[model samples]
Target: MSTTLSPLIDLQLKGFKVYEKNLTLQEAERPLLAAQIFSRRDYYKVLLLESKCVLHYAHQRLELDGGQYLFFTNPHIPYSLELRTDRLHAYACLFTEEFVAAARSESLHQSPLFRIGSTPLFKLPASQADYVRGIFHKMLAEQQGDYPFKGDLIRTYVQLLIHEALHLQPADPVVQPNNAATRLTSLFLELLERLFPIELPTQQLTLKTPQDFADRLAVHVNHLNKAVKQVTGKPTSAHIAGRILDEAKALLQHTDWSVASIATCLGFEYPTYFNNFFKKHTGVTPLSLRRKD
Candidate 1:
């Protein structure tokens, strides 16, 4: 099965949580684990290694030695790690986008770590590794505590890790753009993905149509549609509708929010409207999906 943040967290901790792990795996288990492919998800994952390894990230294959940091992984990329040593000691931090949604709202998508073609693998010197490891250690320790503001503290640590990575020179230089179509399509998709997870009931998705995205990207609707269709092999409207449908299904299946509240969160004026939209795309009502689960 593909690994997502929630299920992976369940293997280690509890709800919407963040924690660090120091792993020592046997060489015999490496091949079995390496064969697994992890698709991207709406979460941020960072790995700091105490031993050597090879990282497979989308089209880039990187060899990272001890005291190295693998840059942040976001939903737009697919990645995995392979250990080279019998006992690999590494610190990995994983947290969902919703966990840091409020704090990083304006800048998460713009981070260099998520920029396509930017190198994400960085080798940290011993001193720098200690500094970064200190933050991870604190997060791991505090996760075991019952402090009232523990979650906020962990968020702060996550921010620190990102900032620390930013302080270093990027591993690879940015690639030149291909064409207007690809650039526009990338911008459009980034804009679309930015307003996601719908963390709060009052937080609604404001961009609900191709025109909304076009205006945000400062392009004419027809131009945006052509660019998106050419790159994604789907109509612009279909992309918007599909993303909305995905978030709707996730909320219905994962949360206890009522159908009406979900509809409002998804920018539908009414619950009935969301019902029809969901039914049109998926063969079942939101209520039924939730119940079936």
Candidate 2:
């Protein structure tokens, strides 16, 4: 994230930045969370970054070999990483949901990038790295010109990267689509889908509580739990907690915010409480996860 101001986003949102003007900056962010970024309070961001070091997020450490690829999450998530070696290579960029805002179309969905449903992070094989690099390299090169559509061009490059990365992933496992065991589980997911700004695996927030989601759905908490479990083979709280953690992972990897800020966002009034809760569930403290990154 860069401290200097830019015209890329509206000023009303409190955001953060970090950037690289030269080579040594890379060494500065050892055990770095994210390279540099700006996040608006109004909307979340989708970031792209490069790294040669291993990263931890979603309870896993991504091997950062040149052929491997991972995602830079928004604040609605949690993520972390630690350098496996002092020498690593990476580049990243941030764009909000509004940044990629476009009308729905086959091209929008069929595009390799936007087609991803839930798991936003993807790993690319050696065969596809060059293809992915070519698109980002072009995006990086575009800054050299005074093109009137530089922003648009960069956005296009990002979209292409998503599509290409998706194209190269292994075939997904068979999970039946919308085949819940009961009507309530379906309703729960429906309500969840409508709840925008969910805890991204890259974020932290209080929306994790069952009551918060229940109030939105206007259903009794126990009823909501039973309904979701009967239909999905998992408790409703499990689903909620899972969503929170997934988003937590995303935020940890993609943003530079401290654990306290992240805890507050995820709904804990106190950061320490949030820390204990997360550690209890994930077996790792938030800062521990961040330090790993």
**Per-model lDDT:** 0.70, 0.55
Give me candidate 1's TM-score against the actual structure.
0.51
Per-prediction tally of clashes: 0, 62
State the lDDT of candidate 2 residue by residue for 1-293, as single tens digits.
33444567433322222222222445546434334334332333233335455555433356665345646454433444555554445555455555555522444333334332334566666566666666656765655444556666666766676656566555662234554245455556645533435334354343456777677667788878877777667787777776666656555655777777777676677988878878988899888777776
lDDT of 1 by residue, 26-102 (tens): 44333222212221244567767667777766444688765567467665554556778766666666666667775
Off by over 4 Å in 1: 1-16, 22-40, 105-107, 170-293
- Over 4 Å off in model 2, which ranges? 1-37, 40-66, 70-75, 82-88, 97-117, 169-178, 182-235, 238-293
- Point out the worst 10-residue segment of candidate 1 by lDDT: 31-40
**Cα RMSD, model 1:** 11.0
